[model samples]
Target chain A: MAKTTTPPDQNGTKTLSDQAYQRLRSDIIHGVLQPDEKLRVEHLRQEYGVGASPLREALSRLTADGFVTAEGQRGFLVAPMSEEDLADITRLRILLEKQALCQSIESGDDAWESQIVAAFYQLEKVEESTDRDPVEWEVRNHDFHEALIAGCTSKWLRRFYSILYDQHKRYRNIALSTEIPRDLHQEHEELRNAALERDQKRAGDAIEHHILRTAEITQRVLREESLQKKERA
Target chain B: MAKTTTPPDQNGTKTLSDQAYQRLRSDIIHGVLQPDEKLRVEHLRQEYGVGASPLREALSRLTADGFVTAEGQRGFLVAPMSEEDLADITRLRILLEKQALCQSIESGDDAWESQIVAAFYQLEKVEESTDRDPVEWEVRNHDFHEALIAGCTSKWLRRFYSILYDQHKRYRNIALSTEIPRDLHQEHEELRNAALERDQKRAGDAIEHHILRTAEITQRVLREESLQKKERA
Candidate 1:
């Protein structure tokens, strides 16, 4: 069993497994481990300074989130990404996002609308600070979209959205390695405006367009990479 | 390492891990092990007549399929279901199914159309049978929907759809203890007719309606279950 080791946090404590889980999850998500790379318990224990038990538990949780795959005694590996998966994930994201926007528009209160506006403002700020670093902007961008759909009453819808968003982030990172068109910011602005005005149909359309555009761009990049690899071979 | 045991067959080969994976997957999916139940490796190894390595490998694969949870030294447990998860899964299924239907409609050839018709006919026959065994109907019903989406080109979309479908099956089984009013056969017919006629809009609408209706029914049942548990307490 993992021990609950919280070092005098005044009010509460955190478990060793929790720490391991967060560390491993971030590593996997941030591409530290690389997709489809084997996750060896012995290596992870040495790297994270955690016991094999806690490390195993963390990997287990990651497996549940679709981020990792356990290959039995062969150990764990980061889940692989492909052009096909990117397209399917994007398509599903669009569908759920549109429905979520509609529901949010129908049920969102003044607070929700204001939050949308605030998130967009922050997003715009992040968009302008391109020279600072892409990482921070990427985080803010995720927050902005999450805020957009925060008013949805369905817990399940939100959870699915989160999963899709995480998957999208991985592909987006890949796209960022290439030349990205500036039109994406403008599209985000349009989506924000539509959401602020509670124009459900317009918001839905904007969201779909935004997602599909990224998918198209990502797919093109992936194809180019494949071609480059083949040329090298 | 799990050894490959050769059972005296023409092929003369079967990996222990592969055998373990198949048996564990079926057991988990078929509800031989209840949700949120702990999976002890030693016990499982003895029970399945497999070694530790093979059992761990099987668990790893099961983890990828969202069937089990790994909790460090606490070992593994079946993934738990919640009402929130159920709703989210259904919403996702609806979204993916709608896209698949759209794609199927646009890209489905004569064979695809015929499959839909054939599946619907078989589905209707199964539904009309007086046995009313939920298990039998459930299996046939899944086959019918899968047939409807068979024309979809995206492998990722189908994979995600299948995952959501399986998750929904778990929840639906729970929901079955409660009374359901709607006739699922009618809904299937509407969806089939729309698809056959290439009425994309109608088909999409019917798909959405069918999914939401099921969600509503399941939600009601889950709510009742919660209430009953509360009263019992």
Candidate 2:
């Protein structure tokens, strides 16, 4: 599993709770832990090979991260995914990403350009490879997008962008195999070229379209799945 | 102290950790707990009359909320405040709040207008009073702003606006006593009127100006305080 985007501590160590938090977050995002699933402390403790204290601490942190929902004294459950949430997150991603992209294009230095090129190259390699590990693609794809906005000076915008990106990823992962065929590589290529050329409007539109396209596909998949579940019921 | 904006759960009962979370969050926002201060689990336990378990859980949650910073095994500390952070947060608040305000004004019904009027009435009552409690003003002020945006259909936008508003409050609280005199009540009235008239541009501009005006005051106060501290050092 890819470690969380959050870096290690100053001393380069991950505490047990931190480890648990990352594990649980990764599981939730990857759908290993299904949405709305109960996160029983006993079950997680045995599953994760950790004690109850660390597991509980991890769940508490995840609650704040929106990966888990606290049920008063009843304990915690994985946050449910829905079409409304996906749409909301996607809209936000478009808003913040466009703002950040504009800022990056306006003030990005040569170093920023190099970073974007390097990240995109790595991502493109993985995309072109015959055997693409979804996990590797996830990391590389995230890195490529992060590079695009690395020049935005606003920390708060960047922070929210990261959060929205991760939340959107949960939906993206669920729709990965189920999505309609599209030229994702071409989409990224257009974004990269526009960003590198400092074409703010083009870059912004590319990103907005990219995000909306995925959201549309994901929403459709969710709708179909829910309908099938209803029929089964 | 005002209860958190987060409503109680379905059971209408808060867990011990939830209680601790509210108290700690309030204290931090009110500056009763100093920024960057080490949150000794033992000290917080004694101070809040909660057990270590609940306190730890609260701290964990607060770290996610950005009210506290987790320092690995060293435990958590109150999140530090700075002029730069305040500026970043204020900028985000403006962006999100304006988006929400425009949407609300565009779609608001009579019920939404009534909410705004009621909240404004309560806020004005406190603003016009001689013996105004800052705590009461805070609650009413939050409600008034919340009411203006209540008509917005996008829950994600509202959620982010709330988060950014509370984060900005930490700075606003610190500068409350030191800020220059301004007609805050008048600003709100302008916003309320604009919103009620369904003037999207006017309401958006009013909120933008209102937030920027306070941010300017708070930034100046923070700058002067930092200078004084430097001189003393």
Candidate 3:
């Protein structure tokens, strides 16, 4: 599990509920808790060294992020993923992401262009290395995409996009462990170049194609995984 | 406030938390709890005649909807709206809605087209009346737009778009009592005609322009309101 390095309580002023919320969010996002897993307040309290009150508070915040579902008095459970949900998530991601890329192309400055270059270089380095862990590569991949969209001016759009992106990432991790197609990298490179040239139409077109292709590939892998599980059953 | 019909209990068994969550969600969406209002769980518990546990669950769900903010142990508060958030929201709505409209036009069967026509007729009836309870108009407006996209096959895009629509509604209501342009109904009528014609490009273009124009008008009103408030302060 990835460890969180929350700043030390230099003033001894950290709230118990805040600590519990941070730990739980990290755990859920990092797949420490299985999807649709029941979350018992008492169990989490004991594990995180917090009390019931603070544990409840932490769980409430996570519920807001769609990481957990509240079953009224039955307690919270990690949200479940289904093939239907996967399709929907990918469709939404494509819609928002393409728009974000267009906005980034229209508004991005030289600094933003340089950041995209930097992110692409870092992503290439990580993709080329076989010795590094898969998890690290996944993190770097997320960072590169984030950097690409950093020039989008809409804060609310960015925030919602981040949530959708994280949800999609969780599903992507479960579906396949293989390297994404080289064509995906090539498409990104084209998209970066188009944006740098301030060709909004081409940038938008490249982003739409890039996103839809990933969805197509991932959906196929997910369908195959489901079929395999059914065969075993 | 729109009353939600509760599911009847077979054995006279009802959970306090379930009741609280439904009521609170309705209130938030219906504009009973104003935006940016501080939400004290203890106060809510007393107001709703529920215990702490159930009230906590209700708050948790609201937080997820971006309607409320959880401050850990300090308690929850309603999410704030500003001109900035409204503008970002409108921009996103234009992008997603246009895509959804285009998809619906390209793929809608006769039944889907009929539904859009019926929804437009109903909307026309509501718009004909001069009784300007913005709240009622708001609800009808949502039904009309949802009907427009009802033919779109992707559930995830619908879900994401609904969230954005709700947030946009909140901001719209905040600025509703202010002055708006008189030709809004004409624009809706034109959009309906475009959709009926099955001209995907024209329909998408009309919807995008309509959405952006509304957003621009509301944003101007909000900015003026802020200036007034500042002057009073």
Candidate 4:
């Protein structure tokens, strides 16, 4: 239900296609639409309050981003999640995150450091708050990590990292539960300290560990969920 | 004008936006539309013989792929090329490719090896033939390289690699000249052999050398071209 501001096109009116694209993308990412779910244009038209052309256009864009899979003439489906896909995404995440971290450390100035610190402080406050909203925490978490790589000047690298991050997010969303015990606060604080201190190696290693740990937990949760569904069936 | 055989939508007819997207993407990749050139929608509508709506949608999609840049309400422009951009692109290509090569080697079966052999044979034939059609060579060359990583099971890695390849292609296309000598045939042959033999390290190193050599040569040529233009100005 987050109303992400859509950047307008030339005529100053946001295109119906852009609106449809943003709505569908966020819905898919936030797990409102489940993985492997069919994305019928007619249903989407009624759901998103858009016409067929704009909906199809939006689905095409999502297909390119790996968020939706095209089923020949059958329309689109939300991209399926699997352990193999997660491994691919997380492994590349480590490499790109290291590259981003090292570049950020080398190129970041006082302003960049302060920005990162501010982001982390906000995230920590949200984490420690009694009335912590999940959506707010997710946004803060995304911002804190974005701040980490804000100094890497490669638009292409950042773009790929963001896409892969979203793909990974889809998996993590469905797997979220209270049972997995990770001291994410301690991990974030350590990562923030290393980053601020300009310790590239420590920061890089910490990110790899953090990502891999989360991937491991998510894989277990996903598998368990699948098993429970099967048992109920 | 290579027709890429556009995959049909639900209607069995390609959307106008898709047709526009492919044309613009190929034009940008082939350097027909120069980098940094403003992509005026009214002008493009006339140029591509498409409607305003579809053309804009296509531009938005290309913008996401980094082929075009959206300048807020000012609309889109062909993404500009620079030495720094090339460096960022080539460096990531090296890492992702190495990973792809290793994974492909481990996962590829005899079928994969045969596919590489077939692609390389066609490439070598095209290279040695009297009719040195640039477009044909370009397609064959793309296929040859794609075959190298065909065994890699990671869709995310392959997807990123493909995007970077297109971006790198834009640079190579603009930098193409009769000067700067590289024994591309020998390099391709060695790469093919390594891939068939399942020599991950050798294949990885070969790819690194091949990519770096091209990057270095392209950088020099681009600088020279810029200097000559400045002098003429």
Prediction 1 TM-score vs. true: 0.77
- What lDDT does each candidate get? 0.77, 0.87, 0.76, 0.85
Candidate 3 local lDDT, A97-128, one digit each (tens): 87787788778888898888898888778777
DockQ of each: 0.29, 0.68, 0.44, 0.36
Docking class of 1: acceptable
User: Least lDDT summed over 10 consecutive residues: which range in candidate 3 chain B?
Assistant: B6-15
Ranking by DockQ: 2, 3, 4, 1
> In model 4, which regions exceed 4 Å deviation?
A1-17, A40-55, A177-181, B1-16, B40-54, B129-131, B177-180
Best by DockQ: 2
Ranking by lDDT: 2, 4, 1, 3
TM-score of each: 0.77, 0.92, 0.83, 0.85
Give me the runs in candidate 2 sitting further than 4 Å from their true place: A1-13, A177-180, B1-13
State what share of the real interface contacts each candidate retains: 0.30, 0.86, 0.60, 0.30
Q: List, residue by residue over A120-160, the lDDT tens digit for candidate 2.
A: 99999988887777789889999999899989999878877
Q: Per-residue lDDT for B1-233 in model 1, tens only?
A: 66589444422225576687667766766667777888888898889888876677567656656677766446789888777777777777888899898899988899998888887887788788776666667777887898788889876567667777877776776666554646988899999999989898999999999988888888888888789889999
Q: Which candidate number has the best TM-score?
A: 2
Q: For candidate 3, lDDT tens digit of each residue in B69-162?
A: 8763577788877877888888878888887888888888898878878877777777788776666677778888987887788765676688
Against the native chain B, each candidate's TM-score is 0.87, 0.90, 0.86, 0.91
Question: After TM-score superposition, what is the CA distance of residue A78 in candidate 4 from its true location, in Å?
Answer: 2.5
